[model samples]
Target: MVAPRDNWVVDGLGATHEFDRLHAVEHRHHHDGGGGELHARGRTIRDVADVLCAAPLDPRIVAAIRACHALGCDLRILSDANRFFIDAVLDHHGLRGYFSEVTTSLSRVDADGRLRIAPYHDFHAGTHGCCLGTCPRNMCKGQALDRIRASTAAATGGKKQRLIYLGDGRGDYCPSLRLEREDLMMPRKGFPVWNLI
Candidate 1:
């Protein structure tokens, strides 16, 4: 069955919408210990990961990814989603090998098996200078795009590859600004990013 637009599953805690596994675990951890109205209901991050791994990928998207790889295109995934979810989805769909690089939020499970999520570029540390001030505190996709472009150019003997960005979120706006006139931005129609652009 097709999941909801937000990909949320209704649990005993009523309507809880978690975008990724890390957030789901964090939510459960917050209420699990309090004996409150909302609890984990014995679900862990591992369970969330398993569900995400089993989630199906669109065959069209997988075919497009394979076609890009076959054509010698350097495929990169820059997502605000946590590493666990992104990696799990890609690996599960057998699309991990197509990506030249994957950048995502840092995540780790503690000794107690509680998941911890951190910003890729620590906002408290003043790591990024996003003039728009619209991106998330966890990461500035524009800065990450700059770094990726520079690194790609350096590795490819100073020739910058053309960028074709496909995004559907508000965070994608900043990076869309970074793209050159020659590059293409494929923002999902009716999404915040499309409206912003």
Candidate 2:
């Protein structure tokens, strides 16, 4: 399943609900909690990173990703996961160089190697101005896609293009609404976003 990167990485897939408790307090008080992601087993950052790195990566998915890059597609990641986790996962799977840019909602890792996630939009400051209620408080995938499209157009000297999105979460639904007639929206079967469509 495609994990939601907005609030956290995954729900049941090795995600640490322990960090959620900390995040809740931090989010409520609008302050830093000085904590990064934690494993469900209460392991530290290094241990979790090691475990996640050792996790099995499906070969079929990796090949598909490789094929897309081989086709000269400009792959970009718009993940809610922190840069550290995303980079670690991609690098471990030998898929880091396939993407051109990663528009992730995360701050840099601390010197101590803790992965501190920054909101895509600062919830404490103001709203993301999105009417789509499906969007998470940390980020709006639709707005981010618009920015990416604008940048792509600018880079191509205003040339038009199409998009093919493959996603399976509530946040992914907002971006599907932004797709044009020529764009493809491939929501994973039985996911919340698929049912929403």
Candidate 3:
């Protein structure tokens, strides 16, 4: 799954080294309600988005998206990022309608416009038996890909469809392994997944 674009979060925030530090803490403490400290810092989700969402959309990616949509490629987004952030980016570029599906961490804006995000699978409330060592505990992209394939099969009367997965992270490795012989995996060059392969 693709997290919020790096340009919006990391570099845009001028905190290149802070992402791992921040994300690691969040992942570990999320189930334990350890995020109270972060909120106590007076930095709400809205505040972050207000700054990061101002990054200009990449034209090359936008052109590619339009081309794929025009060709009826059945586009979808599988992202680790929350919907609020993804929607904000998509809405900024008027590209929200281009995708048939967007699978991500669920999010909603509270009455006060604070973004509340939840894991796609509640890792704390119930058991999620991934059995694979490669994925984040909150959600497994391989399982998610399997579900997407099942859904598409149901939609198309059980016809087999080839898939093309493009990703750039260690969490993405699980889904890459799920690809069949006929499917394609495009790992961004020099990224962790590519290095791993």
User: What does each candidate score in C-alpha RMSD?
Assistant: 5.7, 3.7, 3.5
lDDT of 1 at 115: 54
State the weakest 10-residue window (summed lDDT) of model 2: 28-37
Q: What TM-score would candidate 3 get against the native? A: 0.81
lDDT of each residue in 1-197, candidate 1, tens digit only: 11211233223223254323445566433212221221245556666566676566678988898998999988898976666667767777787788878887776666656556666777557746787866766778888889999998899899858999998878899999999988999988998898998
Q: After superposition, how far is residue 168 of candidate 1 from its true place, in Å?
A: 0.6
Best by TM-score: 2
lDDT of each: 0.67, 0.70, 0.71
Q: What TM-score, computed on C-alpha atoms, does each candidate reach?
A: 0.78, 0.82, 0.81
Q: List clashing residue pairs in candidate 1.
A: none
Separate clash counts for every candidate: 0, 0, 0
Candidate 3 stretches with Cα past 4 Å from truth are 1-39, 55-57
- Writing each residue's lDDT as its tens digit, candidate 3 over 59-139 gives 888888889899989888887666777887887677889999998778665665445668877877874677767666667
C-alpha lDDT of residue 33 in model 3: 27
Q: Give a tens-digit lDDT track for model 2, residues 8-114.
A: 33333345465466567655311132334432245456654565576556788789899999998888887545566677788778888988888766766566665
Ranking by lDDT: 3, 2, 1
Candidate 1: lDDT of 79? 76
- In angstroms, give how far residue 176 of model 1 lies from its true place: 0.6
